[model samples]
Every structure is written in structure tokens, then in C-alpha cells.
Target: MELTQRIKQRLREVEDWNVVRDELETEAASHADKSEQSRALYDLARACESVFLDKAHAMTCYQQAFKCDQSNLTALRHAREIYQEMAHLEMVARLMGLELARNTDASIQPSLSYDFGMAMLNQRKIDEAKSHLEAAQSLEPSNERYSDRFQEVLYDRGKWQLGLENVMVQLRALTGSDDPLGSDVVKRGHPLSALFLRAARILQQESPDDPKLLPCLFKSLDADPSNDEAGYLAETILGNGGHLQHVQKLQDRRIANTDAPEAKLALMLAAANVWHVRLNKPEMADYFYHQALDLAFNEAIVDVGWGSDWFLAAYRRLAQGADESGNADSLVPLAERGMSMLGEVDCSILALSAGELAWKKFKDVDTARRFFSRAAKLAPDHPQVVAFRRAEGLDDEAKTTKLPAMAPEAEVLTRELPVADDDDAVDVRVDETPRRSTFVDPASAAEPEPTRTPEVDAEPEASPEPEPEPEPEPEPEPELDVEVE
Candidate 1:
């Protein structure tokens, strides 16, 4: 053939390998005969591999060569090599599977089947991996690696089956179904739930605004509420207000269930979000927000295992609600309670809020200073903390005022009580007689009393002195007179 001669002549030329590859590719395109084209493409692929080291391009050429001639073992081997090096395990598995299917030779089938099985294992195609691996083991019972890989596949398959059983159980729980046969179907584990969740996640990542994703996410969550990814998708759904009726139905069901605190919290958060964002009813939103936070806090406190982190998250939601409602006054108490309840937890927002409220709303400079100082301690580099400190001149030293000293007379006077001694005692007597009248009645006060009293008193005054003692002794002798007296 002219093309083959031209290809040989071009290969012998002193031209660059790239030029030779281009000429061969041109020759390959020009040829109408499948055999000639296959030879030219194969040569071109070799040129690309040796000179350019472009395995991907060479693989393409080898694929074309194999399509032109199915008996092209070189093309198959080179393509398989390139795929293996690229870690295209799925492609290698497919290629080897096809080779095994086409080849009737038992010896070559065992090697190809083993390679296919290994590739399938790498691709996580466990069932196919198991089948081909078992076949290889049967063909060459002495191959330990094939047995090991097969055992691994069997172990993975068992785990996969168990996971599917769990998913089915969750599905039945969500749907409130009593189908006994559902377990049988999922006992071997179909990948439906995982596949659906994966697809939903892909949709969320690729086309978030696509209308179809909401239902997918909702289904994922409905199947398993414990799925954190599904929960996030639910949040996104709620945020967009995409399915209010369904959300409301879920909320109603969760609210009716008194025993499920976590479910109730989730529903409460959802309701709060709906009210705050969609309905624009901040008061109602605040009510639900507080309810959810209260529930979470109670659950955490009762050792229900809803850790302190959950309580802190609830507190943050409450704070967010307060902020959204424009209730700065509420933030004061919230910040205080948050600090007390979340001890040692970083509460910079609460501290900043408390400081701002103290400064602006309460107008208490000292309280504001204390709160701002706390905020600074918590987050010194926070913008609000820095701004507040700068605005209040906290970075500056305080000016001191001195008062003049008091004079001696201006000093405070203190009285001291005299102490009493045990031996020191005093007694005093008082007169009870009434005082004489200073004025006399002129008609009634005659002078007759003065003369008779002076006559009786004068005799005693003259006789008095020495005889008085003897006379007293003589009078003592008269017992009768003394007794009568």
C-alpha cells in the first residue's frame, strides 16, 4: 500500500518525532482500509508515547486502533497500561471484562479475569469484583492475592448489606410502615438511599437554585432525620421557603410528639425561621426561638446528653432572634444569662451587646466600663470592642482630683462615755413637800397663831441645858408614864 510505504519512509526521515506523528495521523485519516488505518494509528500512538509522552493521546489512538481491528493486542495492552497508570480503575475493569468476554482461551481468561477483579475492587464495584475474583480463584486456586481481594470484597459487601438494612429500618420508621417484607428486600442492601442522598447532594452543590433539589433534599431528610447533610438541606429549603406546606406538616407532626425533644427543637427552629424570615412576624419568631432554646437548655441540664454545645447553639439562636427583633433591652438580660449559663464559653457577642446597652440605653458609665472591659478580655481585637474602647477613651489614663485638708475645728467631733468602776456608788434623796404659797389672802390670814407658839417655845429655850439629861433619867424610871407616852 502507498500509505504503508509513505509511513515507513516518514518514520526513516530525520524529521522531529512530532512531525512524524502528524504525518502518520494524516496518513491514518486518509486511508479507507481498516487494516491500513489501524497500522498507521498504531504507529502514530507509538510515536506519541515515545516522543511526547502523551499517554492520554496515545490511549485515544489505541482505542481507535482497537475499534478498527479487534485483534490488536498491542493496542489493548498499551491502553490498559495507560488506564492503570491513570488510576482509571473502572475503565480498566471494563476493558479487562471486555477482553475476558472476547477471548476464548482459558489461560489468558484467568489472568484477564484476575486483573478485572482487582480493577473492579478498586472501583468499589463489589459484586462484579467478587464474581470475577471468584472466577480467577477457581481458575488458579493457588493465587493468594486473588483470594485476599475476594475476601475483602465479601467483607465490604457484608457491611454494605448491614448499612442498607439500617437505612431500610429508618425508612420504615419515617414512613410509619409495617411491611415485614421490606427487610427482606434490603437485607442484601440496594444502594437506593445512598444513591438518592448522593444525587441530592450533587444537585445541591451544582444547581442549588434548581426547583427539583428541594424535594430531593426533603426526601433525604424524611428517610433519615439523623443525616446532618439532609438537615442542612432542610435548612436551605426552609430559608428559601420552597415548600411551606410540607414544612408545616412536618412541624405539626413534630410538635404533636411530646417525647421527641430533638424533633421538637428542630420544628421550633423551623417555625421560628418561617416566622422571622418569611412571615416577617418577629414577635412570633422570638416566641418560638425562645421555646426552642429553653427546650435545648432543659435537655442539656437534665443530662439528656444534649451537650453544652447544643445549649450554646440555642443561646446563639435566641441572641440572633433578639437582634432581629431590634430588642436591645432584651439583649442585656440575654447576655447576662448567657454568660452565667455558658461559663468559660467565649461570649464576646453577649459581652459586646451588654456593653453597648449599658453605654447607650442605660447610660451607666461604670457598668458600661465593666462590660466593655469584659468584652475586651474576651475579644480584645473585635471591631466593636475596639470601637467602643476608642469611643469611651478607655485607652487613656483617668485624671485624679484632690480635695483640700480640713482645719482642726472643722474636724468631726466624737463623744466618749465614762467607764464605771465596780466600787464607786452614789445615792441621793429627794424632798416631796410642796412649796409654800408666795401670796396670802388678806382677809383669811390673821396674825393670831404667832403669839401662842412663841410663849410655849420661850420656856423651853430658857430652861434647857444642864437639867435636861437628869430629868430624862428620872422620866425613864416612871415605866407607866413611859408606856403611856
Candidate 2:
């Protein structure tokens, strides 16, 4: 990387600035190796910034140097410092983010994440900051800088009271978040649900009857219904405090606030689980399962992963419910419909349960065999299926059950989905993880039929009493005659 003689003479003493700049630009553009090109660009940037005083052009040159060779951290660092000195924090963050995107080094990742989170927080980009700061703190939990920064965000936003400061100290030990009680958290509620959940878990353990336990727990859930474990814990809380009604309100509020079908489905499954297991209202669980399918089925048809995950959850939960549910006559078909739509999954539990119910309850051997075969197709080596296969004396090579595929061309799903209006029940998705899928329809009449707003009749309405109309006519005639007189 020796300099050319002509450039070397200029380096010893600048005779003409233009000639030195031109030679450097030429070298940067024509260098065959990226490292050499980056080196040339770095030198060019330095000359432009120091001598020509072209900060903008110098910034571009440094960026280009970094682009040419990421190993040139000096170039990026220079660019970042220049932007920072000029009070362009956003640009500084952008450069930091680029470095992070490469995942070039694990050692500096926490620092970069912490710095990036701070920049975003300063910009009032709470959601973006939430992940990065949380990650930085998690990665370097011992680092007070990272931990304090993240906790500060939650506290400033949470606006906790003095009485709660001790609680906060305890919570920070358990988990570094407050009640997440601000309008800001209310709007997006990130870390809101996570924090609320942590608090709920703590309360459940220490003060199961605390008035705030269920609210905090449900709020945590409504923020992210993806976790499904609220069932048993909720049962415990509700059973102790009997604040089931409060949970109901939260569930309705969450359903009304969110429009994402997946979110709605999560709520539905949560409620269904609560009703099926805790409240022992199997009918209600059946209703919610139907509602969840109606809400999420079409989404499953279209979405690749997330919405479909919710659908599968509702399906599997309903299928599990079907075993003990008094409304199995109706619930089983709804679960089957979801299984058919999913086409195939790694787990066959739903299909296996469906087969068991079909044989033991419905007494339909053929349909039961079909379901069993489908279950076998999903997991040919599953122990349960193997044991069942041996008992049934089925062939080793059972033909795969090919249920009707959720046809991509199936009638554009116009199903009226309808979660709750004014009910006061908390629905906690059971442990399958407020696990994610999107799922549909029941075969039995026990399923509540979709409500239809019938078209209004065009015919004029008749008087409740025709005789009353005649009396009014007589009275009007008598009044008219009196006026004429």
C-alpha cells in the first residue's frame, strides 16, 4: 500500500491540494482489493475533513470506506463521532444499527444494543427501545448501566407511587419492571404484559388474595395472550379472591381493543380454557372455541405462521376440552374442522383425541378409524399411536388419511366473527403456551348458529288493533264537523 511517487511528493509538502485529492480519489476508485480501497477512502476522508473542511463529503467517504471493508471499524467510528458532534443522534444510531446487523462481534453487542436503545428512547420511540434495552440488560444483567437504563424507562413510564417504591425494590429483584401503569404502556403495552405477568406471579405466591393480583395478571395476559399458562394460576387467583368478574371485564376490553384476529383468538382460547377447567362451564368453553375458530379460520387460510399458530392453539385446546366437556356433541366437530384446515402438524394429539371421542362417544368406528389414520400420518412413530395401532390390530402401513384440504379457493371466508360485549370472565390460555395458530365450523346442531340480521320487510305495518284505527277516524270526523259548524 505504498503511495505513488507523485502523491508521495504532495504528502511531503502540498504543492497543489487539488492534485493530492485527485490522486487519492483515483486510488480509492481503482484499488483492486477492498481493504486497499477502504484504506484509500479513509485517507481521502481525513484529507477532506481536515484540509478542505467538507464535513458532508468527508462523512460520505468514511461511510464508503466502512461499506468497502467492515473490518474498518475506525471508519464507522469516525462517521458516528462526526454525526454525534454535529448533533445528529439519529444518524449515529443508524450507523450503530448497521454494525449490529452484521452481528460481527458478540462482545460489543450488549453495548451497541444499550446505546441504540437509548437513542431510540430519546426520540420517544418506546416500542423500538423496549426490545434493545431489554436485550442489553438481559445479556449483561450485572451491568448497572444497562439495567438502570431499562428500569428507568419502565419506571418513568409506570409513574409508581412512594408506597409502591418498596414493591418496586422487590420487583426489581424478581424482575426489573413496575406495574407498567402509564398511558404510554396502555397504548402499546410491551414489556407491559411481561411486567404485569411477573408481578402477578409474585403476588400469586406471596399474597394470593391481593385485590390487584387478577387485574395485574390479566393485564399482563391481555398485553400478550401468547403465553396460555394463565389457566391454573388464574384458577388459583380467582378461586381465592373470586375476582372472576374483573377478569371478565379485562377479557372483553382486550377483545374490543384489538382487531388482529390472532389476538382475538388468543383471548377466546384463554376464556375457553378458564371456563372449561376452572369455572366448569363446558358450554361456555364450547361457545368460545367456536367463536375463536370463526374469528381465526380465515386468517389461518392466509397467514403463514402467526395467525395460524393461534388457530392451532384454539383447535388443540378445544380438542382437549372435548374429552371432559359435556358439550362434546358439538365441540368435537369444531375441533375436527380445525384439524382438517391445518392439513398437517408435527403433533397428532388433536387428531388422536378426535379419534378417541369418535369411537368411544359417537360410536362411529369408521369415522374413528379415519381420525386414527390421520393421527398415524402425523406421527407414525408416536408411542400413543403405536399402542393404539397394536390394540386396534391395524396394518403396519396404514394409508395416510387425506381429509379435505383447506382449499385456497374455498369461498372467501365471510364468517361473522363475533369475542364479547359485556361479560366479566377472565380467559387464560392454558399451558400449550398461549401458543400460537389460526383455525373454523361445527357439524352438530349444538353449535350456536351464526346470528343473522334479517332484512326488514318492505310492507307497511298494520295497526295492532284495526278497531282502534276506526275509532280514531270517527273521532277525527266528529272534530272536523264541529270545526265546520
Which candidate tops TM-score? 2
The superposed Cα distance between candidate 2 and the true structure at residue 286, in angstroms, equals 9.0
Location of the lowest summed lDDT over 10 successive residues in candidate 1: 476-485
RMSD of 1: 48.4
Query: What is candidate 1's local distance difference test score?
Result: 0.47
Give all candidates' CA lDDT scores.
0.47, 0.51
Kindly provide the TM-score of model 1 when superposed on the true structure, using C-alpha atoms.
0.29
RMSD of model 2 against the true structure: 29.6
* Candidate 1 lDDT, 421-459, residue by residue in tens: 212211111123322222121113344232111111210
